[model samples]
Target: MRRQTQECKEYMEAGEKYLDCQDRQLTSVMQDWPKDINHLLLARNKIQVLRDNMFSQFTQLKSLDLQQNDISMVEDGAFSGLSQLTTLLLQHNRLKTASEEVLLPLPRLTYLRLYDNPWSCQCSLDSLVRSLQLPSNRNLGNYAKCAEPLLVVGQKLKKLSVDSLCRDDNQVDRGTGGGDGGRPRLPLIKVKPEATSMCHTYVFPKLLLDCSNKDLDHIPSDLPSDIVKMDLSSNIVKHLRPKQFLLSKDLKLLNLSGNSLRHIDTAAFAGLLYLRELDLSNNSLHYFQYGVLEDLYFLRKLSLGNNPWVCDYNIHYLIYWLKHHPGVSYTGLMCSEPQEFRGWRVEDYVKTYNGECPKDRQTGGMDTGQGGQGGSDNEAQEVAGETGEQLPRPLREKKRNRFEIIRLS
Candidate 1:
């Protein structure tokens, strides 16, 4: 069979079972999609809404790309018949809420992208949030950021706790009473003390907190005990103390991106045993102690991009960790120091360094050099001679005589 490309506002590459209708100003799904098509690309269009049974005919479809559209609504049963679908991309849309009825039908879906949507955090979205929490659909958590309700703007949806969404239910008045002058009065219910203590709002019935861009200088001490997700991005916090998050042991997702953080204690993340994703991007970190991340056995995704990483021998700690954990997404990680290795990827640099200390640096014995001061007994240090910025105080405390590159036993 010869390969063919069909052109008609939308085009299809025949014999390959692929269709490309992107950037065609489409307002709806094209009904003339070839019955044998297995992949469809409909991104960058004007699709405003998804109607019921829209893709019912494409039972064999395996991948659907609808990113960068104007989709605001997805009617129930809209995705009912695409049982073979394994990937769905819906980023950069106008969706306000996603109900389980629109998502539960695609049982084989293994990858879903729903970021950049104006998700209204409320009880209406609780079911969809719960569906995404299932182990089978957990990877979708990385693309579930919210873009609404003022408080949680730019916060990931999966980080939200159920208490944040359902706390409003506690405010409903259920008492039936008679008022003065024979007028019936609606009951007045008091807000929960937990909800009143923090400057957060609900996204799913008490599961997530949208605390992004709150100008907070420190973690809120009064956060709910059972809260699972917290967004502390775009804040002014400079340090992370060990006790700051001592009570948030159940936290699964933490976003500390776009902050002024320069120091993180080794014990700062001590109790976060259940943490899955952490975003420390766009900060002022030059080096991070691997000990801080040692306790996160379940961590799958970590974002350390957009920071001014020194990329010296000291960075071996992070590179070694990243190489061992292939599942972590270390995007935007680049070197910003060392004239020789600048602009190189930290991971790539680690390959070239090969766990060897510089020829001039002392390696056989602990030398309290310029970079080794205040370091702990086990940390390895390398000097870049004032390349970009000095390492933070907490990170400079650990000194090691030799570069012990992690080797899987």
Candidate 2:
């Protein structure tokens, strides 16, 4: 092992393959590091921004420790050329946001420590959040948390609803130039304090309303009609009446998780034709009306996890709907009732039941297999219950020992 100067010490161990420069009060990385060094410790330094290709010379590096530093910004491609890197420690830093481009180069990375940094929750972090959801990074879920946007200050980043992080690019007009070249701009409309007290709204550029965790009994009635996204999770909303969202026709995302929603009327979401995502997890819902979700033709993502679902003939409609719409991504639609079907995934339940309702019960002349092809929408609604017959094959798959649903309630 070779030791450097007194202020900055460098030692090599295990045949000159490891380097330790920790607690050296260094402001920048040493350019003279051994090219063969496989482990480098630079924690407790004064390093700020990480410029692009800063570690390009450390091609053989397998583990890099930079924790407890003052690193706030990591320029795109800063970690290029460290393809062999397997472990990276970046905890306890000043990083507020991380982009996918910054971490995409480390294909061999198996362990990453990114906790203790202040993270800003916004559209810019959407890519990072999605990348972390991959099965390979599932272990990092608990280590990531939001530090800004007070509404979700201490919540885990992975647990945050996707709608909260994704913002519609077209809704926000970012360009300063107007149609009339260089004309004088009109006075801006100042938002009132009352609006802020009810919910946080960003009026400039575009409108975003956040009313989550506010203990609200109902949706705010004074919101602007053009608002693009709204979060109403963790509240006391019990029921959704007809045309409940008529005023917010332009809303593209809605979050109603962790609420006391026991009933949702047929036309509860009638006016939200453009809604792209909806979260109804962690509620008291037993069954959704047969056609309650038919209007959400544009919805691409839906979360129905952690609810007490009654898996009976009433649930056949949902199964039929899910089977036909392969484009929709959903999670946690498992059975919680009906002793025979408990814990079975909704999709599996549909397959096991084969759209056949129990013969002993009456279905009020409703179609159990609504999404089957060759059946018109009118036929789907008018068909009566299945004839009393033998049950379809039961699910022979092993039951899940632990549910993956997140309990927000």
Candidate 3:
């Protein structure tokens, strides 16, 4: 019987058909079980134990699906020979960590899915976490949870610290705390620049930048002069000034999501001749001003969703603006405001002013004769919600568990 089992295993290694090892309740698998099996599907099985040399022979295995198993511990070097393996689906498993040495051999691997597993989020798991930080490795950050009571407190598997999340059984540390404990002393990784990133190669024409969490309280004074796209999401900015933008000639897409912007000077976006897409979603903007977008004649998309827009004398400007601008996409957006003005269009504010802006243009005499923001035309209106009252920040630092929906309230 042993000879027959070994023969079947070896037979599969010689480019023969594979075993139907589904739901086999395999408690212990042999090291040289099946060396030639190019494809293995051991999903929904009771396979609890896997040896280091278990798959050291399948050099050509491209796809291995070991999902939905009772695997608790995986030996080091278990998958040392899968150099060409591109897809590894280990979802719904009981395994905790896959060592660095074990994964160092997977040279051509690209996709790795290990979601819904019991991850300890320790330094012992640093190998897998470090594997993802490599510039050559693509799409490796999947479903990594911060375990619990740690720096990252949640379980959607976004990113686990390579050195902070895991334990170093091999090394000794004097730090006091449990595995996946202790605050991580690292900045959010910025892999590539917004415009020239290899990841942005596909979305080159429309790229997103991450100037957020760069510890910037104000917009950078030296932004790209001719950028077509910019993503300034997740930052701590309080207000917008005209000198902040230094507008680009071809600027089209701008993402200001997740910020502390309480006020925006309307004339701040003066030189954006080709501006089209603007995303102001998920912000602490308690006031809404139509003049910020007044000069954007070609502006097609504007996202004021997730903001507490109090309907005052000028709230009608937005409805008037919306009525004129068509084909704009609001991402599941809604307004939470005056019962009468609730769900109103951007063109609704036109009643207050006869197509003329209500801006206090007298304030711009000291600056450019054109005025700061909201200074473009004589028909401009003053910003409606710039009452020096600042609202509390809804988003916490790295607290991604909150509801990040920016809506018109």
Q: Give me the candidate number with maximum TM-score.
A: 1
lDDT of 2 by residue, 381-404 (tens): 333223323222133344543533
Q: Where does candidate 2 clash, by residue pair?
A: none
**lDDT tens digits, residue span 1-409, model 3:** 1234432322243443454455666655556565666666666768786667677677777766676778777777778778878767565677666666766767777766555566666666666667766777555545434443234444334444445554544233323445546645344343222221111111111333335456467776535444567777777877888746654667788788788778888777777767788888777665556677666778777777777665565565565566667655555234446676666543443343344433432324322333324533332222212422222233323434344321121
Model 3 residue 335 distance off true place after TM-score fit, in angstroms: 34
Q: Give the Cα lDDT of each candidate.
A: 0.70, 0.72, 0.57
Stretches of candidate 2 exceeding 4 Å from the true structure: 5-9, 12-16, 168-409
Off by over 4 Å in 3: 1-19, 28-35, 149-151, 155-158, 161-163, 166-409
Clashes of each: 26, 0, 41
- Local accuracy of candidate 1 as per-residue lDDT tens digits, 1-409: 3243344233344444666766778887756667667787777789888998898888888888887789999998889899998878776678888788887778888777676566877788888887777776765644455544444544567777656776664222223332234444443333222221233423222246566877778776555455688888888999998756777788899899999999888888888888899999999999887677777778988888888889777788887777777877667788988877788988888788675555554334544343336452333334323222233333445555353332211
- Using lDDT as the yardstick, the better of models 2 and 3 is 2
Distance from true location, Cα of 262 in model 1, Å: 18
TM-score of each: 0.43, 0.40, 0.37
